[model samples]
Target: MDIAEVLTLADDLIFAKTGKHLDYVQDAILRGTLEDATYTQIAQELYSSPSHVRNVGSDLWKTLSKGLKKNITKNNFRAVLENSKIYNYQSAIVGENVTVGENVTVNHNFNVCPEKARSPKTPQNPEPTAKQPRIDLGDAPEISTFFDRKSELTTLENWILSRTRLITILGLSGIGKTALTLELIPQIQHEFDCIIWRSLRDAPPLASLQTDIIKFLSQQQETNPPNSPLSRGGEEIQPASPRRGEEIQPLSPPLSKGGLGGVIHHLRSQRCLIILDDVQTIFSSQQLAGNYKPGYENYGAFFKQIAESCHNSCIILISWEKPREIAALESHQKNCQTLQLNGLGESAREIFTEKGLSESEKWSELIDLYQGNPLWLNTVAAAIQDLFSGKVSEFLSYDSLVLGDLEYLLNKHFQRLSDSEKQVMSWLANQNKPVEISKKPALLELSPSEFLKAVESLRRRLLIEKVQKGDRTLFAVQRAIAEYLNS
Candidate 1:
């Protein structure tokens, strides 16, 4: 494959497993090695010492091998590449039909390679464009400029293809669950005969959804030109709807109702994909109790019916928390497969590096403080860009991030905890050393029993992790959790 396609594939592979992008060093080393450049030559080209080049090469090999689910070394990495379809990628640069591996071998004149210039890489512009304004809404309020979520996209695609009956993505707010779902749709559109995306915020009544389904199915029939009675063009060619007395129109191609009942009637036979965004807003337990309080509506039965009946169609649920009914579907202790998205990875430095800090140590510290949440990373980056005018050294010397809207976004999630819980968490965060909870109860000003209850609650919620040292179980809030509480 051409070098551009090769880079995209490499990105896809790395992101698919680790949910992180390839850093610049990784990208540069991989490309350099692919072109058969020795460590010394690569060092010269990349402006690094030969030893640094070798270390980067070693790290790249380990990262790629782990991501690709196979062992790979620089010597064998190219062999694997040659065997993969990406190696045969076609490139039409200046009307030259150049197959990546055949026409442009990596050896003798590697520096003159055209693929190096055409690689699909993030630009070196370190700062976010001025057009992207700072926005702060609850959950994912801000648009992250440094998003590198390739693996999550790949995993979503795999879920669409694999034999799994149902796939649910569960995570806390602002974790990029929605962003990841939207990114995967365009890539996997061809896999499904029908792809219907709906936001549950304004979930129509059952009748409206049923009617909408029939209308959608009819449109599909017209496009595919299936031999069904409903397939007829009108004077102005209006979209198809089931014949008034037809009762149930078949859903699949060459549609026939084989007891899938009327709702799915014709649509059940084909491979379909339905994505429900913000499912938590619609699938609440309180809604099913017939209490029409604001957003309460029992969608449990609707979900259960769809899951139990549909065979070829896969239903994707994206929610902040798992709905009870969906969680109960898995028999035994095997819970439904849930992909809990965390934060962006350290590789985001490649993005920051473009704005102009090439040093790894400085970038590592920034990523550590932000924990690599794309939105947060971008926010701090914007502040740094504005404050220092792209001076990486000056930016690192600062004590705190401006945090624009991140503080408010974090407050919403943190406010859900009880007052005592917040207080205990803050205490743990301020402690200079790991405070043994059993003995340090007086320091926290909580009775022994109450302290135990509060600590257990935090652990259950995954806000805190217990560090066991001999007989003492010291408690500390997780970095992200602590940041939210402290903010």
Candidate 2:
């Protein structure tokens, strides 16, 4: 039975006993219980004390027991109601097996107790009190070599604790945005009721992504496992043991039906931490940063709702490009926030030390050249090891940037640029030094306004660097990027 059916049962039973309908707290408790939430989680959601919630639950359960003239308790309430839904049958429980209709079919190795019996887990049985939220870190890479980002971690924690509803960790590929988030999860998972990490690398449509997430967050488990023994039109039904990992508590019903509306309901009711990685894939290439691709524009509305709505949940977006709404909607006291991740500094020496690179004194020069990007440094460090036996000084003697696998990484970013952006990048690559905007080459047929817009776009994309010469603003591409373009 779903939440509504259970609630109707509760109301009918309670009203018959006391001639009073369920109150607000009573209704909230039923919703929380149906979702497999602990009393503490429900209490926190309603800003009420756990003791108070338990007190109300106890009184309510006693009333139910009187109305039914049968044993009814918190753990068994759902089971009793569900069992009542089954068609007329001759049933008996023998140890871990429940037999129906003359023992023609037996559900073996299962928990079939109306009185909280324990064996192989089934929906009717009560599971242990849950302290951890349900987690699904799909395709979220493990942090094998995380460089310290203590400050960033602290900032993210503070924002989440303070109820920031939306956060975007923005940076170029190879930066430690994904790494930092992976590390942060262990430190904060206990604070939420559900935590999920999804990768947008494949750019799954919003509806598909939303549906997948809803299914995970849902209290209702998926359809029968391949081993389920029951089929429709057949009288006998056998509930099988959990096919996956440890058993999940059975939900009375899902708060969400499935879609944007369903998603928002779950977010508002449960404390969820949703991490969306590789968000750039949902955005259009060859355009300014954060413009969603044609079919993906609805993500803007979804993100805006996350930021504008009053909810206790949090959504974290990890991307190479900042979404347009991020700059426009974020405020000092608002729930929306953005973190543009930069490179690791001295902490990055660990990558060199791990790579067995020599000339510790020259490591900083190499790090500075690669802008302390972890993946870029790792790629170059390997080339240095193969070509120069891990000698930093020997590699430096060549005075040429080492971009082995980095070329592929850079090419991925290059492929996403607009024509204006490409022309600006080409111009910057050939420049001898940082030059003022007024000194554009005549051959680069762009007007002043177009040049400035392209430069600004590239800056937001982290493809070009800005410098100050006297009082004039100067811009130039990084050596590795320039070399990639020039090559």
Q: Which 10-residue window in model 1 sums to the lowest lDDT?
A: 127-136
Winner by lDDT: 2
TM-score of each: 0.52, 0.67
* Candidate number with greatest TM-score: 2
Positional deviation of 7 in candidate 2, in angstroms?
29
TM-score of 1: 0.52
Give the Å error, residue 306, model 2: 1.0
lDDT of 1 at 418: 57
Q: Write the per-residue lDDT of candidate 2 for residues 188-277, one digit (tens) a residue.
A: 875576788999999999899888888776642345332211121222223222333434222213634777877776676557899999
Which digits, one per residue and each the tens of the lDDT, describe model 1 over residues 303-339?
Answer: 5565555354566777755555664575412213567
